[model samples]
Target: MATTRKQHSEQSAPGPVAAFARFVGCGGGVGVASSFAVAGLASWIPWALANALVTAVSTLLATELHARFTFGAGRHATWRQHVQSAGSAAAAYAVTCLAMVVLQQLVATPGAVLEQVVYLSASALTGIARFAVLRLVVFARSRTQATAPAPAVRPVRAAAPAGPAELCPAA
Candidate 1:
C-alpha cells in the first residue's frame, strides 16, 4: 500500500492576518540583529551612515521574509505591493522616531536609557502599524469564487410507494 499526502490549497491555509503578524515579528527580529551589526560597525564608519545602512539591510531582509513566508511559498509579490508595505513600515518608523525625539527633548534623560527606550518604543509601534496596513491593503483579497465556500452535500433517499404498491399486488 502506498500513502498519499493531501495537497492543501492556499485558501485553506492559515489566516492572512495571522501570517502577516508573524512576518512583522520576524522583521522586528531582523531589525534587532541589524541594530547590533550597526552598533559594531559604527565604531569604524560614520554613525549616521552606519545606522542608515543597518536600516536598509534589515528592511530588505524583513520584506523578503514577509514575501516568502507570510504571503505563502511560491507567491511572488509585485513591486507595487512591496512599495506599499515598505511605505507603511517607513511611516510607522518615522512616527515612532519623531515621538522618541520629542520625548527625549522634553525629559532630558540620560543618553543610554533614552536610547534603549526610544528603540523599544519604535519597534513596537512599527510592528503594530505594519500588521494593520498589511492586513488591510497588501494582502486584501477579493470576495470572488476563490474564497467561496464549498457546496453542501446531502444524502439521497428513495421515495416511498404512494399506496404501498397497491397493497402488495395480490401477492
Candidate 2:
C-alpha cells in the first residue's frame, strides 16, 4: 500500500513534553503487561530469570513503539537503537531488582501488592531516564534527518547561445 505525506508526517517529531507523555504511555503499557508476564514466568522459573526474559522482550516492543509514536521516528527502530534501548532496559532491570531487594529487606513478608508497588515505582522512574536516552542518543539522528528541510534546487539555465558573439555573428 502507498503511504501519503500526511500519513508519513503524522508522527512528525513531537515536542519534548508530548514525546515524554507518549514515552510513558508506551513504556508504562508494556511495563504493566511485562510485570504480569514475569509473575507468570516466575511460577516455572527463578524470579530473576523471569524478569530478565520479560525485560528483553518488552524492551524490543517498547523501543518499536517509542520509535514510531513517541520519538516520531515514523518507522521501526534500528538495530543500533534496539541495542541501545536494551542497555537502558538493563539499567532499569537493575533498578527494579535493587528496589525489590530493598523491599524484601525492609519487610520480612511483603505482600504481592507491596512488591508490585516497589517494582512499578522503580520501573516508572527508570522509564523517564530511558526516554531521555532514547530521544537524545538512540533516535536523535533519525528525527533530525526526517524533519530536516529539503535542500533548495536552482533551475539549470541553458547556454545563452554564446551571448554577444553569437548574436552579432548570426545577425
Per-candidate TM-scores read 0.62, 0.84
The numbered model that scores best in lDDT is 2
lDDT of 1 at 96: 53
lDDT of each: 0.63, 0.88
Count backbone overlaps in model 1. Answer: 0
Who wins the TM-score comparison?
2
lDDT of 1 by residue, 37-67 (tens): 7668767996456666766666667766765
Off by over 4 Å in 2: 1-7, 153-171
Assess candidate 2 and give its TM-score to the true structure: 0.84
